[model samples]
Target chain A: DQQVKQNSPSLSVQEGRISILNCDYTNSMFDYFLWYKKYPAEGPTFLISISSIKDKNEDGRFTVFLNKSAKHLSLHIVPSQPGDSAVYFCAAYPNYGGVTNKLIFGTGTLLAVQP
Target chain B: AAGVIQSPRHLIKEKRETATLKCYPIPRHDTVYWYQQGPGQDPQFLISFYEKMQSDKGSIPDRFSAQQFSDYHSELNMSSLELGDSALYFCASSSLGGGRSDTQYFGPGTRLTVL
Candidate 1:
């Protein structure tokens, strides 16, 4: 069940350019979305998140825009640095009354920022 | 700053062997999640626990079982392992009631290789 999908497997950008990564989900139960950055031999690091109620959330050079009607979300990194190169995974959590809200992940997009 | 910790960063086992992976969440986190990532693939959710109780389950194989302890740490037990089981296993944790509680912080991951 590929509820969450990242159509792009790889994205390449020059340093100081903007990198855009996108994700889509089919399940409307997902009320929380997040973007994670992962390096080889390590775990995923939380980069940014956007709640369903908000259309955009920004932190420094990172911005996440959510479009609930389209069931899509995108991550924008401005002035991409070489250090920003990594595999980015988009994850979503369904709204649940229970204490545990599990996440569904996309296939991931490998962003390469060329120096 | 504390982060999730997973043990046996690397493990090798035979097809029929059994293995147990451990996870220690960040201080005071109340929920834990388990994910498996095959080479060249995104992390797949397996199971989760909240307040030491099983809260959700995913595509985990029948030979696998997991539980949260009274201390809030979690363990995933895999029996009758197969070569396909070889992957990187990650553990993540989050608190239930903070502004950032919905965000998950991942561990370094355990690389399991079935021989």
Candidate 2:
């Protein structure tokens, strides 16, 4: 079953505007959430993350807000630049089965920033 | 800064052949994870290792096997390769014990194509 979902497959935004990407998870046991951005032929790169203990985490121009009750989280990039265009994947880490953490990923959202 | 390293960024093999993918974690990183991503799909977890031991398992096929060495490097071995095995394989590393190393660092993926 798909535990994590990113319903919007694509998003388009103007440069210097706000870019928001959303993700939802069905597994409440997930304790850590992260966002990764990927370009064609490249591995996904880390963007931002928030632990379930907190509602929000900010890294400079990027902010991630998590709503635990809603089982949803979103990444907001302000003053979005054209270079920010890429496919973004939302991943959740579930510390289950007494093993190391395993990440569950969503289908990803493609962001196109028009300059 | 050091980043995760992967070898043979691209590989082509015939059906029934075997292929080996290698990953070298960043210095002092102790955890390794493997993921496979197909066209238009999210990365799926295969397995993870902690301190040279198997820590978690995911949707890995029976024909596939993996191990982490004492040096903190990991290798994925695929046997009886099939066309369906074509995908981008990524190796991610995390320190897991301390610091921002909790965040996983992904290497440039290896693209494996089986004909």
- Per-residue lDDT tens digits for candidate 1, residues A16-113, read 99999999999998888999999999999999999898999999999999999999999999989999999999998877655445678999999999
Clashing pairs in 1: none
The most accurate candidate by DockQ is 1
lDDT of 2 by residue, A24-103 (tens): 99998888899999999888899998999999999998999999999999999998999999999999878664444567
Candidate 1 has an lDDT of 0.91
Which regions of candidate 1 are displaced past 4 Å? A96-100, B97-101
lDDT of candidate 2 over B1-115, digit per residue (tens)? 9999999899999999999999999899999999999988999999888889888788999999999999999999999999999999999999873122168889999999999
The local lDDT score (0 to 100) that residue A105 gets in candidate 2 is: 93
